[model samples]
Target chain A: MTRDSSSTLPAPPALFDTAVVAGVGLIGGSVALGLRQRLLARRVIGLDASPEVLREALALGVVDEIQTAPGEWLRAADLVVLAAPMRALAPLARDLAPFLNPHALVTDVGSVKGGIAAEMERLGVRSFVAGHPMAGSERGGVTHARAALLENAVWVLTPTDHTPLTALSRARTLVESLGGAPVVMPPDAHDALVATISHLPYLASLAMTHMVARDERLSLLAAGGFRDLTRVASGDPRMSRDMVVENKGALREALARFRRQLERLEADLDEPDELLAAALEGKRTRDSLPIVKRSLLPQRHDLVVAVPDRPNQLGAVTQTLGAHGVNIKDIEVLAIREDGGAVRLGLESPEDVQRAAGILAAEGFEVRGRS
Target chain B: MTRDSSSTLPAPPALFDTAVVAGVGLIGGSVALGLRQRLLARRVIGLDASPEVLREALALGVVDEIQTAPGEWLRAADLVVLAAPMRALAPLARDLAPFLNPHALVTDVGSVKGGIAAEMERLGVRSFVAGHPMAGSERGGVTHARAALLENAVWVLTPTDHTPLTALSRARTLVESLGGAPVVMPPDAHDALVATISHLPYLASLAMTHMVARDERLSLLAAGGFRDLTRVASGDPRMSRDMVVENKGALREALARFRRQLERLEADLDEPDELLAAALEGKRTRDSLPIVKRSLLPQRHDLVVAVPDRPNQLGAVTQTLGAHGVNIKDIEVLAIREDGGAVRLGLESPEDVQRAAGILAAEGFEVRGRS
Candidate 1:
């Protein structure tokens, strides 16, 4: 509820004297745009191995200065964000250690965090915060970068025990000014969570793409469903490869669990009862997702209620939830039967579901399912 | 080129004396609506084991007559469509044989064709056409059904070698009247193709959902890409399970191929060059799909062009294609560079891609990739 848009950000021109954004791609360029648009930096410096991209970033006004080899820029930078591929963050830490002012805050926008934090610890990048802005598009490059790219997105920061509170607050402040909802987590927890949500899907898409890529007949017959299922498969190969490679441990675990679940479904294919139950489970799980809300995170309970067939049944249920201060995100008549139909209510947050369910059940309503 | 929208369809009342749709689900109800909307059916009858669905379908005006059982209505039927799940198709055939007139046409709308075709054959149903309307949504039910559901969609008919020409023509005419593009193929081929393109992705989604559904943290952080990738996974569990079960052989094969491709990419994660190439290949294949146009099926070739950096470069390319009568469905600058960048063009069909590419290349444009 506290999340605000970037348009409301006050000019914070002295937040950082000179900030460097390495590898000026979409995410990197967005960071630069946010810094400039919010006036958080006096000068935003761009650094990329691709000279053409660096020049384009400069021409697009993504940065006030371009760092060709990172000597003077790194020495002058009050903050350095390694907005490069996941694989490059640790190695770049050592490369920038010599030039970086010992007091300057160093962080990154890598998908994986724990290993990167550990690697940075080994590389002696002491003043560092592991960060990831969960805002991106299938498109890449500085041309697509927008100042509001991070608006309403989750910006996760993973600070180790060695990190100071000042750095965390600084990162949180920047995230907020750029219209991001900042969430703090342990580095490993962040890695594990992203692995399941992001990396696992990337690989799933990749596998499915490769599967159907060879089937010309199937590709011709492919419909919207298949297209949607594999849309992320068209991601930049290098970046995708880097994510899996860097987060191998977490991704491997997720993939293994995915494979096991698939095998279980495959086995249950012959058992109609089990298959139907699993299929319903899939529906319940999917419906439970807080897709209707614009939360930086998913927070909802899919509460299935069996309401008696009466004139004011649905109205009574809504009034009850309203009185309990629980907001219903979505409500659907999932099934209709003789005695009462099953109404699935999506409530904002698990706490809301419990409170609303308690109120409804106490009022002689049948609470069937919550996922 | 001959494709037309349903709005242009003539209202030819009394095209068919009697038409019955078994199982009043989305597809079944849509068929009845299309038939009635196009004025192709004078009297449309509905039948479903579930009396509630039958009653709803009637109330929705999807059918004029309701058939309690396959008794009297089928004997007078000019056309009969088994619109139930795949598992129910064979039994319905047997149940209808006694009532069906010898000359009456029988068809079905099952996702998997071969197994159902075989089952019908075993049941001695000779006047059958296996069909699949390549039109569907994540949501199902008669309430969601529309007369225009099949408009501009592919209605594939899989007629075995034993099928009569009259039955095939009848099915094609009905599909066309419903504003669908009719394509004919053998039943087994249809099954294999759908297994790879549709069933494989369904399983992949199921595996992913089951995998991450247990991970509350990942579900919280699930983003748009993940949602789209898993959208198909929330399908009617019974329908999804039936698809995989009926076409288990082909699905298993596709799954194996997918697993192999994944393993290959997994092995080459350390090799950046190989992984990047594979990723690019994935993009190329995905881009090749006709995502822009609403074709009966995916038919366009994705053409990649390297155009010189100029203000009128894009306009010139579009003008050239316009002059050649090659309609571009979608065009995007895939990558940007200093003097020129890579542009991907989605042409309506492969012929258009070849013609458009020829014109562009002859004018000194570099055609980089075509798939």
Candidate 2:
């Protein structure tokens, strides 16, 4: 078997002829779904230690086939994606190396990339690329597999010196085709960054939950604020535990910095004027932040017509716009009610609004400018 | 001035003849506004060292009158609400004692209750209640004050043995009239509880924010997750400072517990299988929690209506609902697009849905079942 050299090139047709996903959970299932949806492979197989999970994946249409023997699955697959627990990667990689497809491009979706990358290289899979998709809900399952989950999300791909350019490029293309924005970085840098952004926050949320758990009154009094802060604490404890344990040093550093910030705040509390002023500053900054960041794309210039809040207004408005010979690019209903409501119609040009309005007035329904 | 001792009776007209609101900022302004809005006071006066804030309070209708001198304001008011910084409350109480109306009921909106209560008692305020309204956005100012800000939110009242029954009852009624759920507890208990639920979380958020600030790359990668987690860090630095300082012991205890939780999580990460399983279990429990807890009182029954991509659907639907005599208590446009959208409506009852659907059908809308 001849391995591809250019890390940035697309995988050849023969590359993923048989791909093995080593875990059939949410991330694994989703990857399988995405690959199958895109017709990226001829056969997408799954290898899970749990017989029950493997069966569930097959039943749920997560994988076309499940291999009962790990070595057998490893031997046949042209590509392997490790989607196991962070700690399981090392042992699993070690166990599968002898039977592995020599030319296969191995990658992982583990949150911590440095240790996993080091382990893979130690196991002689130097061509392995560590990747983490920055997409997930508070829930997880094989049943949650959706091809659109990674769409428009960041997919961090970590490549070390030993990583083949062809393997890296193939992984990049695969992720991009799934609608993910690929961000490339070194393994150690990726690990540290993730620990600061993802791992530290998880730990913070867990600690918050634990603190509340210790106090009966506080927990009972918790409103939306506490709920929002501890929302991520409800994530899988096993996953969190693995993340925290694997990224202990970075988490500690993050925590220490956090503790220092707290001390600074505590000091300010002793001075009322200073504290209040500081709070005011914070309030000013926060209030100015836009509810949602503006989209990267520009707004479409369309002549929008809206229906007023009233009954039978929509049909009248649509008929009017339709009669105006103006193509309706978009129609948005701002509101609806039992008696009447408003509809916003988007036209290709601003000139369409006046014409549409005239047509609507003749249709005997109340119309208005776009809301 | 005559003060009524009838604990169950409405406060006498003269009881709050000259109400003084200290530190006329967001909470103070809201209290002043609520007092006026509810007609619970004869006069709403402001007391703030900052001339600009006092002027703003008067201009924004947060206070009926402004006082340049704290002593003068304290002497005239029958009810004195110390809505100042926690650290400032102690010294302010001392200064106000000489001018305090002999029968004035003093209270505060400070997060830390025990320390403030002790300081007030030391200053010879015989009748006082330490109160904290668990209502506020991440915003602050007289501009942010709303008469209904406290409505239906938790207002914790911490009263001591020396707190007159009449005063405590009056405070309870005031809180209830402002649309708050009164939760009465001892001062120390209240402080300890808040330290865990409120103060500790603020510190944690600040810590997380600081950690992100330390890493330029990590900060750049910060998205909704980190933004949401560190939201409280953007809160008034002074308020956070006071909370951490005055409630240090309790906060420290909470922090210690949180750190221990992180340590345990770290250990679990090191030992993956057992820890990962536990973390996953936690995530499952968290995801299933109700979006909002059922209120102690009857809450507005809301339905999320998911509509197909179309124009003027909202107006048609709302008109239909309105025609069927369904009063929309609140309306939230969750998602809006040129083609279609999803709207959530707060209604009086679930039975309103049937009538709503009928109205939509009459308006030529393809209405669906409530989400």
Q: Which candidate should be chosen as best, given DockQ against the real structure?
A: 1
* Model 1 TM-score (2 dp): 0.73
For candidate 2, write residues A1-371 as lDDT tens digits.
Answer: 11122322222232257889888788888888877765556689988899898999889777899976576556777778888877687887787777887788788888888788888788888668889987776568787877667655678999999899988987886676455668899977777787777777787676566555545455557656667776777766666676778877776666566667666656665565765665555444433333322121123332323344434545655655565676777775533443333444656654676666666555443444332
- Any residue pairs clashing in model 1, and if so which? none
Each candidate: fraction of true contacts kept? 0.60, 0.46
Instruction: Look at candidate 1 and tell me the lDDT of residue B56.
Output: 91
iRMSD for every model = 2.0, 3.6
Candidate 1: lDDT of B118? 82
RMSD of each: 18.2, 17.7
In the range A47-162, model 1's lDDT, one tens digit per residue, is: 88888998899899999988767675588888888987777776677677779887778888888888878877887777788898888876787899886677667888999998
Q: Write down the worst ten-residue block by lDDT for model 1 chain B.
A: B1-10
Q: Candidate 2 chain A — worst ten consecutive residues by lDDT sum?
A: A1-10
Model 2 Cα lDDT, one tens digit per residue, B1-371: 11122322222232256888988877889888888865557799999898999989888878889886765546667888988777688887787778888788788898888888888778778878889988786678888988667766678999998889888987886776555778999998887788776777776665555555555556546765666766776766666776777887777676667667766766665566756664664455444433433353455454545455545556755766776688888775544444445565767776775666555545444433322
